[model samples]
Target: MSKKKGWVEQTDGYLNKTPTFQFILVTILFALWAIAASLNDILITQFKSVFQLSDFATAFVQSAFYGGYFLVAIPAALFIKKNSYKLAIIAGLTFFSLGCFLFFPASRLATYSVFLIAIFVIAIGLSFLETSADTYSSLLGPRRLATVRLNISQTFNAIGGIIGILLGKYLVFTDHNLQEEMARLSDAEAIKFGQQVLQRTLTPYIYVLIVLIVMIILFSVTKFPSGKVRKKSGEIDSAKFGETMNYLLHNKRYWRGVLAQFFYMGVQTGVWSFTMRLALDMFPHFNEKYVANFMLYSYICFFVGRFLASYLLSRFRETIVLTVYAVIGTVMLIGTTFIPNMIAIYLAVGVSLLLGPGWPTIYARTLETVDDKRHTETAGAIIVMAIVGGAVLPVIQGLISDATTMQFSFIATAVEFAWVAWYFISEIKYDIRSTVTNKSHSLED
Candidate 1:
C-alpha cells in the first residue's frame, strides 16, 4: 500500500522530506503565476479609459485574456500529457515571460487591441502553467500533503496580486489624466502627451520584465522535484483530444467536478473582476486602495480556507464539509443580495474564505474516484474549464453592470453559487452511493 495517509501524517513527512532550495524556487515560480494571473485587475480602469469601452467591451478583455485558456488547453494538456512535466513547465514559463515582455511593446504602442493581443499571448502561456504547476505541486511530496505544498507556494501568488494592484494603482494610473488631457488636442499635440503616458508606464514594466526574465532563467536552471511524475509519450494523435473529451463526458464523477469547477470559477471570477466597480458603486466611502485591500484580505481568507481544509476535511466527511461551506457561501451571497451597502461588498468578498479548500477537495475526491491513467487529461480539462468561468462569467458580469447597477450584478454571481450548492448536493448523494457500494464490495473482497 502507498500508505493512504491523511494531511497531518503528510505534513509531518513533509517537514522531513522537503528541501529548502525547493521552497525558494517554488515560491518564486508561484510569484510569477500570481503576477501574470492578476494583471487584468491592476489595469481595469486604464483599459476602460484607453479603449473608450463600455463594460461589455472591457468584459471581453477578460474573455480574450482567459479565452486563450480554451484555445490552448487541449494542446497544453496534451503537451504535458505526452511529455515530461518538466518540459511543459519550461515551455510554459518561457512563453509566460515572453508574454510579460509583450506588455512592454503594447505599452509603447498605446494600442488597445495590441494590449488585448498581448494578454491573449500571456494567457496562452499561462494555460500551460496553470495545468502543469498545480499538478506538479501535487506530485511533489506525499500525496496527502499536496494541498499544503500548493497552498504555501500559492501565497506568493497573492503577494503578487498585492504588488500588481499597488503597481497598477500607483504606476499605471499615475499620469492617466495627462494622457487624457493630451488626447483632447490635435493628433500631433496628443502624440507628445501620449509619449509621456507610454514612457512613465513603459519604464516600470521594463523593470518588471527584466526581473521576470531573470526569474525565468533561475527556474530554468533549478531542479524541481517530479514525484511519481510519469511523462506520457506517443504521436500527436489528434484523435486523443476527441477521446479525452468523450472520456470526461462519459465519466459522471469527473463531469460533476467539471460543473463544480465551472460554478466555482464563476464565483471566484465574479468577485475579483467586479470588486473595484462594485466598491465604487455601492460603498462610496471606500476608495480604490480600500477595495484593493479588501480583495487582498479576501484572498488571505482564501489562503486560510485552504490551510484549514487540512484539518477540516480529515475530521468530517468531505461531502458534509463541502455542504456546510456551500451553504455558508450561499448565505453570504444572499446576504449581499439584501444589503445595498458596503455590508454587501464585505460579505461578497468574504465568501472566498469558505471557498479556498473546495477546489482541492473536489480534485482529491474526483481523482480518487476515477481511473489513474486519466489524471493528466482530466486535470487539464478541469483547470481549463475553470478558465471558461473566467472567460464567460466576467464578460457577462461586465455586460450586466453596464445594463443596470453594479448592485444588481450580484444576481449573476448568485446564480453561480447556486450551481455550486447543487454540486455539494451531488457529492452528498454520491457519498451515500460510495458508502453502500464499498460495504458490499468489502463483503465480496
Candidate 2:
C-alpha cells in the first residue's frame, strides 16, 4: 500500500513541477499551426478548380508551403537559441498574422502564385511555432513523460484541424457546383465568379489573422518562465551553437529518426492533400462541402486516436506502439490504393487513426537521445525541417496522379509508411541486442 502511495506521490510531483499556465499557452501554439496546416486540404481542392490546374500544378501549393519550413527552420532555431521561447513564439505569431493578412491581397488579385506566396509565409510562421512549441512542451515535464505530454498537446492540434476544415467547408468551398456552371458562362462571367469565390476564401483567413493578433497581445502581457537551463552564472549558454550542431550531426539515432520523420510527414501530407480529390473521384455526385465534412470526420477520428494512443503509451513502450501503428498505416494505405468505391474513402480516413501518433512519437523518441539542453533548439529545428517531406512527396504524388490515376498515386504514401515501419523494427532489434550485449558484459565483469 505504501509503495503504491509513493508512486502516486511521485506522479503528482512530476505534474506539479510543470508550469500549468505556460504549458497551456504553448499548447495553444500547437493548435494554431494545426489550423493553418489542415486548411491546405481546402486550398488544394479549391485552387485546383479556381485556377484550372492539373494535379501536378496544384501540388505546388504544398511545395511552396512546406518549402518555407525547410528554409526557415534552422534560422528559427538560431533565433530561439539566441533569445527565449517566449520571444520566439511572439515572432512566430507576428509572422502568422502577417501571412494571414496577405491572403486578402492574394484573393483580390486572384493569382495562384500570390496565394502560394501567402501559404509560404504562413508556413514560415508555423515552422517557428512548431520548433519552439514542440521542444517547449517536452521541456516542461519529466523526460519519461515527454511522449505523453506531446501527444496530449497534439490532441489540441487535431481539434484545431477539425475547426479549420469546418470553416473551409462552410466559407471557402461553394455548394453551387461552380465547375459545371462556369462551363455555360461567357469568359467575363466566369472571371467574375472566380473572383467572388476567391474573395469568399479570404474571409476565414481574416478571422485567423484577428485571432493571431489577440494571441500575440495576450502572450506579450503574460509573464512566462525563462524556459532555459541556467549555467553556473545563471545565464543561458549561447556559445555552444556550433558544438551542438556537430553533436546532432554525429548522433546516429537522431539522423535515423530524422529520416523516419521525413517519410512520416510525406505520407501524412500526401494523404490529406489528396483526400478531397479522392472523395470527388470516388463519389462524383458529392459536393465539396460534403467531402469537407468527411475531412472533419477524419480529423475527429485523428483527435480521438491521439488520446487513445497517449493512453496506450502510458502502458506500453512507445517504439512498440509506434511500430504497430506504422504497420497498420502501411496496410491501410495499401488498402486505399487497391480498394474500390467508398471502401477506399473509409480506408483513407482509417489511415489517420494509425498516423495520429507517428509525429509526436518519432519526435519524442529522437529528442530523448540528445544529451544537451542548449541544443534543444537546433535539434528541434532539424526535426521540423523533415517537414520538407510534406513538400516533396505530395508533388511526387501529384505527378503520379497526373500521369496515371489518383488512386494509383497513393502508392507513394504506402511506400513511405512501409519505410517507417521498417525503421521502428530496426530500432527495436537494435535495442534488444544492445540490452543483451550489456548484460553479458556486466556478467563477465
Candidate 3:
C-alpha cells in the first residue's frame, strides 16, 4: 500500500513540474488533431453516398489523408529541427486553417477529387502538429512520465473525437429523407442535390477554421518554452539522412517498434473506419446517426481507458501493461470476428479499451531507446511515416470486405494486434528503466 502511494506521488511530482499553461495548450492541440482525424469516418460514409463510390473507393479517403502524413513527415521533422517546436506548431496551424478553408472551394466545385485534395492538405498540417506536439509533450517533464503525459493529452483527443463524430452526425450526415429524395431525382437534379449535400459538409469545417485561426493568433503572441536542438559541447551536429537511415536500420529494437507501430496504427484506423459498417451489418435497420453515436461511445470508452491505463502504468512496467492490453485487444477482436450478434458489436467496442494505451506507450517506449536527442526528431518522423499503415491496411480491409464480409475484414485487425502483442513479448528484456537510467547518467556526466 505504501509502495502504491509512492508511485502516485512520483507521477504527481512530474505532473506538477510541467508548466500548467503549456500542458493545457498542448492538450488542446492533441484534441484538435483528434477532431480532424475522426471526421474522416463521417467523410467515408457521406462520400460513399455523395459520390456513389464503392467500398474500395471510399477507402481512398484514408489513403489520401494518411498519405499526406507519410509524405509530410520528413519535411515536418526537418522544419522542427531547423526551427523550434513553436514554429512548427504555428506552421501546422497555418496549413490546417488553410485546408479547412479550402473546403469552401471543394464544396463549391462539388468534386470528390477536390475534397480529397482538401483532406490531404489538412493531413499535411496534422503531420506537422502530431510530430511536434508528440515530441513536445514527451519532453515536457521527467522522461519516465512521457507516456503518462501523452495519455493525458490524448484523453482530450478522445473527447475531440467524440465531438467530431457528434458534429458530423448532426450537421454533416444528411437526413434519410434527403438521401431518399436525391435517389429519386433525375440525373441532373441528383447532381445538384449532391452538390447541396457536399456544401453542408463545409459548415463544420468553417467553424473549425475559425477556431484554428484563433489558436494561431494566440500561439503567435504567447511565449512557448524553447524546444531547441540539443548540442554536444555547444556544437550542433546536423543529422544526415543516410547516416540516420543506416543507424535506424541497424537497430533491431528500433525497427521492431516501428513495425509494431505500423500494425497498431493499421488496426486502429481500420477498425474505426469500419465501425459504422460493422454496426449497420449487424443491425440493418439502424441509421448513420445510430452508428455515429456508437462511434462516439467507442471514443468515450477510449477516453476512460486512457485514464485507466495511465493509472495502471503508474503501478506497473509499461511494456508489461502494453503486452497485456495487446493480448486482450486481440482476444476481443477474435470474439468480434467469430461471434455474429449484438455480442460481437459489444466485443468490437471493447477493443477500444485495449487500444487506448498502445500508441502512446509504444511511442514513448521506442523514443526511450534512442540515445541521441538529435535523432529524436527524425525518429518521430519515421514513426509518423508508419501512419501510412493506417492508409494501407484499411484499404486492404475494405477490399477484403468488398470481397467477403465486414466481420471477416476484421481478421486483418486481429492479426495486427497479435503482432503488437508479440512485439512487446519479444522485446521484454529491453526495459525502459534501463534506458532512463542510462540517459540520466549521460546527462550527469
- Judged by TM-score, which candidate is best? 2
lDDT of 1 by residue, 8-40 (tens): 112111222555565566566666666665557
Q: Model 2 segments beyond 4 Å from truth? A: 1-16, 430-445
* Leading candidate by lDDT: 2
Q: Which lDDT values do the candidates have, in the order given?
A: 0.66, 0.83, 0.82
Scored by Cα lDDT, where does model 1 land?
0.66
Please state every model's RMSD to the true fold in angstroms: 5.5, 4.8, 5.8
For 1-445, candidate 3 gives per-residue lDDT tens digits of 0122112112221322466677788789988988898999988877876788777888899999999999999999889878778899999999999889889999989899999999999999999999889888866666566767787887888899888898899988754634346678999988988988888788889789988998898889876655444343434445776777777787778888888999999988988898887887777667777678778888888888888888898888777988999999998898888898888888787788888888887887787677766578889888888889998999998898889888888888999999999999987777765788889999999
Error of 2 at 14 (Å): 11
Clash pairs, model 3 backbone: none
- Point out where model 1 deviates above 4 Å: 1-28, 174-208, 224-246, 283-290, 432-445
**RMSD over all Cα atoms, model 1:** 5.5
Please give the range of 10 consecutive residues that has the lowest summed lDDT in model 1.
Answer: 5-14
If the candidates were sorted by their lDDT against the true structure, best first, what order would they fall in?
A: 2, 3, 1
Task: Give the Cα error of residue 301 in candidate 3, in Å.
Answer: 0.8
